[model samples]
Target: MSKRILITGAAGFLGSHLCDKFIAEGYEVLGMDNLITGDLKNIEHLFGNENFVFHHHDVTNFVHVPGQLDYILHFASPASPIDYLKIPIQTLKVGSLGTHNLLGLAKEKNARILIASTSEVYGDPLVHPQTEEYYGNVNTIGPRGVYDEAKRFQESITMAYHRFHGLETRIVRIFNTYGPRMRLNDGRVIPAFIGQALRGEDLTVFGDGSQTRSFCYVDDQVDGIYRLLLSDYSDPVNIGNPHEITIKDFAEEIIKLTATDQKVIYKPLPKDDPMQRQPNITRAKEILGWEPKVDRAEGMKITYEYFKSLTPEELNKKDHKDFSKHIRK
Candidate 1:
């Protein structure tokens, strides 16, 4: 009998990659997604594979999968600021209610569960180079709080399940990750900037562009997550590239890489936006023996090529212009 794993949010950027990884490892992968932020194109290639099956269901509702299961990876939440802000209630619900549903499902199946947490939990840090120990400075009523607090609540309940119910649980704090299959108009920095450049539009820099982010290639993130799922350690572990770069410098780097003459334009920064974000992977290194092998220069080039492969309509879509629609709600 082959191992079986159920992965929610399996159609999203990271989740799709995980589906590929687990299937490659010979696990019968049962993928689920609501398609609110996920696109079918990401996982379309796996449609014909015998080892893969997909469920077009929302994790906020009760999730049911027939038969034995060995693992459940709960990753079904609106991750980007644009999507979450537009659908704030859904974001909060998915992270809180959606996670609760998955936890209950995990208990019923007796499968080990892994929930994807984010670096945003360390919002607008008072401490530099964020560690897992740092309690975040977040405005609960602020706009970004929809996603941040939901994830914080996710971590809380997951720990509760582990302690009270003795359900096996794992949490991974993911940082800035980019690669192919990302929605060009999702409004994340990498895809936004690349979309702008591909469409010959000016790159829009929010604020003075001093905010920093560390980019982890998708492969490295999945590798770390896979290891964390199998590891005995239950506490949250930060899984991301520790190398940090500022928005201003990163914009300049993108311009250089694309060799585009278009200049950057400025926009007002949103509220509660973190000034810095870099993961402290001391635990990941010691435990998983893992660190990102792909550098920004290498990763960005690959990401850029992916953006270039999209249709002109996708590249030039007006939705990428977060103009006033997503301005802190």
Candidate 2:
């Protein structure tokens, strides 16, 4: 029988890609998502595939899988700053209660599970180029705390399960990733800048744009996740590109990529936003033999093409949810 795997948040960008990867590898893929921040369009192509099935469910509630499961990729949560800021409570529940539900299901099915973690755990790092050993400098009460804390808690519970229950588990701290099928209005720097350029608007730079980030292409990210899931090691690993760039420089690069004449404009930086975020991937290199393969120029070209293909309406819209009212003072 083909190995079966359940992927939570399967309608999401990364999750949908995982569904595609597993399905292509001849594994039976069961996808579940509440569509809170995820879009059905990401996984719409798989609807007719016999090896792929989907459930419309929230992971915050009890998760029930009916058959023998070989693996679970727990990725259900509000990922972006905009989404989490808008629905902070749900974000907390999905990470805490949702992760607990999935871990329970994994235990019941005897499945190897991997939970999606983020570089946000590092939270304005005092240590440059954060490594797995570095304890992060996160503010538990900040606006962004809802996401960082939830992920930290998820990791804690996952580790406990691994130690006490002896369940097969993996944790991946994903860094900034971008690619095709990204929602143009999701409010990440990639889509945000691309959308602004496409609409002939100025690129908005927060806090003089000196903050730094390292980006990995979606394919590279998925590849790293796949490798980590199958590896023997159980500790947390950082999976992301190490090619660091400043936000100001990134904006200039986007302008060049889009061939737009618009200049950048500065605004007050959001509270608790990280000043630097780059993963130290030595653990990943040694353990999983994974490194990001796509360079920014090549990856940015592909991403730009995808966004350029969107409808004019999609190009014009700010976001599906009007979270402007939720902006913290």
Candidate 3:
């Protein structure tokens, strides 16, 4: 019998890519998503594949896996600020109740589970080049807290499951990842800049644009996640490219790449924004024997091409003017 794996949020940017990876490896893949922040277009290409099966269901409710399972990757959370703000309660429910529901399934099926954690847990971190050991300085009541605290709570319970239940669990702290399939209007920096540049709109920069962030390509992120699932790294391990860049310089690069004459506009920064973020992937290197091979310029080029393929109307409807300053409450 072939191995079967369940991937929550399988229609999402990273989740879709993971579905491709697992299917390519010859495992039977069960992709589950409620299409909340995820879109069907992202996974439509795989609909005809015999090895792939998709379920339009929310994991926050009960999940019923039909066949024998080998792994469960819990990645169903509203990641972007735009998303969580608009659906704060659903975001919290998915991360908290959804995770608990998945853990229950994992226990019954005896499958290894991987919970997708985030670098936000290190919120506005006091330490630079954040290592896995640094506890975060996060605002519990801030606009971004709904998403951040939910993830923090997710990690807490996942660890408890491992200690108390002896159910094998893995946690990966992902950083700023970008690629195709990301909603152009999700308010993430990469897609926002690319969308504006593509349409000849001024690129918005928040707070002088000096905040630093690292970017990891989708392929590299999936590579590290795959390694972690096969390995024994139960604690939360940071999986991201350690290459850090300023928001100003990043926008400048995008403008130049697109050869857009659009001006850079400044906006007020959101509350409790992190000044710097870079992952310390020393553990990933030593344990998973992995590191991101794609550089920023190369990754950006690929993502830009994907955005260029969309029609003007599609771009306009999906792209918003500017939501960087706004926070979800």
Candidate 4:
């Protein structure tokens, strides 16, 4: 009998990709999501596979595990600022109650669990290249605080479970990642730029556009996640690309690739925005034997092509001006 793994938010960008990975590897994969931020179209292709099963359920509520599970990948939180801000209470509930529920399930079944964490825990970090050791400088009451604090609380509870119950738990602090199947209007930088370029609109830059961020392609992120799941690490590990680029430069690169005549438009930066966010993946390299394989330019090109496949009307509807408003330089 093949091993079974439960993936929360299986309809999400990363979660969908994980579903594909696990199914391709011959595991019985159960994908669960509420379809709030996740879409059914993302996982539609997997319906034909015998090993894949989809469940329309919210992780914030009690989740019933169907069979004996070998692993559980908890990635059901509201990820984007626009998403979490719009659904702040749900975000908190998912992070706090949802995580606790899943941890309980892990303990009940003696399954190893991996919680999907974010670099936001290192809120507006004081360090240049943030490592797992650097405690963040986050604002608890700010708008983004709903997501940040929720994730911070999630990590705290995860640690408690690890120490008290000895539940085999893994936490990954993921940085900015983009790829195919990502919602064009989800408000992340890559999709935002691609959407604007495809629509022949201005590529808006926030603040002075000098704020820098590093991006990891979806494939590389999945690779790192896979390695970490198979490894023996219990602490939170950072999984992201180390390459850094300014928002302005990143916009320009997208424009150049898409050949869009769009110009740059500057806007006020959002409150408590991190000026720089680059991951220190030394632990990933040393422990997981992983490093980001795809560069930003290459990743952007692939992502742009995916955006280009959408109809102009579909692309226009997702115009995410406010999402980028906060992260502007």
Cα RMSD for candidates in order: 2.7, 2.1, 3.0, 3.8
Off by over 4 Å in 4: 319-329
- lDDT by candidate, in order shown: 0.90, 0.92, 0.91, 0.89
Best by the lDDT measure = 2
> What is the Å distance of residue 200 in model 4 from its true position?
0.8
The global Cα lDDT (0 to 1) of model 1 is 0.90
Per-residue lDDT of candidate 3, residues 155-209 (tens digit): 9999999999999999999999999888887889999999999888999999999
**TM-score for each prediction?**
0.96, 0.97, 0.96, 0.96
Candidate 1 off by > 4 Å: 320-329
Error of 1 at 200 (Å): 0.8
The per-prediction tally of clashing pairs is: 0, 0, 0, 3
Local accuracy of candidate 4 as per-residue lDDT tens digits, 204-311: 888999999999999999999988998999999999999999999988898899997899999999999889999999999999999998987788888888888987
* Candidate 4 collision pairs: 206-328, 206-329, 270-326
The TM-score measured for candidate 1 stands at: 0.96
Which 10-residue span in candidate 1 carries the lowest summed lDDT? 320-329
Clashing pairs in 3: none
Error of 3 at 199 (Å): 0.9
Per residue, candidate 2 scores C-alpha lDDT tens digits across 1-329 of 99999999999988999999999889999999988778889999999999999999988888888879999999898888889988898888899999999999999999999999999989999998999988799999999999999999999999999999999999999999999977777869999999999999999999989999999999999999999999998999999999999999999999999998999999999999999988999999999999988999999999999999998988898886665553443
lDDT of 1 by residue, 30-69 (tens): 9999887787888999999999999999888888899998
